[model samples]
Target: MRQGLGTQLRHLIDLLDGAVSAAYDEAGIDYRPRYTPVMRALEGGQPHTVSQIAEAAGITQPAATQTVALMIKEGLLESSPGVRDARQKVVRLSARGRDLLPQLHLCWQATRAAADSLDGDLPYPLSEALAAAIAALQHQPFGARIRKARAAITKETS
Candidate 1:
């Protein structure tokens, strides 16, 4: 049996994340690869709401909220209730997070260079292909395409 798109993508994620996580571990940094997006969003050194982080990080709001909670617990981030909307939480990088920036930036640069090398080895750059996929999905969501395919398959079986 052949692997599906989701399976292949998951494997790719596992490979990339495993390497990145290992690099961080080897560097003596207590950081998770999953925190990169949020870290990048917070590097401006300003407090932002979860929605803002989600938008900046290109992740879902729920994912942002969850990551925020984990980061806060890890001491990489601190949060307080929004001034205008007490229900909303404003998030900022903690002093601990700031301390890690110099090291993290170096690690990130090396990781990015490695990715560039991998891209060069391919006939098509993975980053370009990924960007194209994102654009296509934005134009017509995967759900809409799945529904159309499902309808056709059902009609044929019926």
Candidate 2:
């Protein structure tokens, strides 16, 4: 039972990833898997510091910095000059990033539809049971974090 649950969870994640990737490709967007964190952070609030982005993304500062720098170079994000401390910069999405929101929304809708379709294939009781299990699992601490991150993605699309 435990193994089956684990497999189901893993497969769910795989399905979501594949759906999102396919949607992104269909939208003619250059998708960077790492961008999800930054986008989520931006959705949570504006002008996130490098540390903030790192924390939300669950990545090291160096990785966040590298990712942020790349985004900046791509004109997806811009850094505001530090007011209190000259060394600290606040980062926000640029015009390009704003323009991409609609495409991202489409991607999310497609993914959700795919999930719904997949769910519909299962027999009634199994589908209901599987959903309940998944929901219960999501209420756990680790699962909570995943849910929060997923919420952030939804926020970004809005």
Best by lDDT: 1
| Residue-pair clash count for candidate 1 | 0
- Model 2 lDDT on a 0 to 1 scale: 0.79
Candidate 2 — worst ten consecutive residues by lDDT sum? 122-131
Where is the poorest 10-residue window by lDDT in model 1? 28-37
Give the per-residue lDDT of model 1 (tens digit) for 54-89: 999999999999999999999999999999999989
Each model's C-alpha lDDT?
Answer: 0.97, 0.79
How much is the lDDT of residue 112 in candidate 1?
Answer: 98
- The C-alpha stretches of model 1 lying farther than 4 A from their native spots are none
Residue 14 C-alpha lDDT in model 2: 85
RMSD for all candidates, in order, please. Answer: 1.0, 12.0
Candidate 2 per-residue lDDT, tens place, 43-153, comes to 644788899899987778999999999999988899987778878988988888877777776776676676678768867654677668667766765567779999999
Can you give the TM-score per candidate against the true fold?
0.96, 0.57
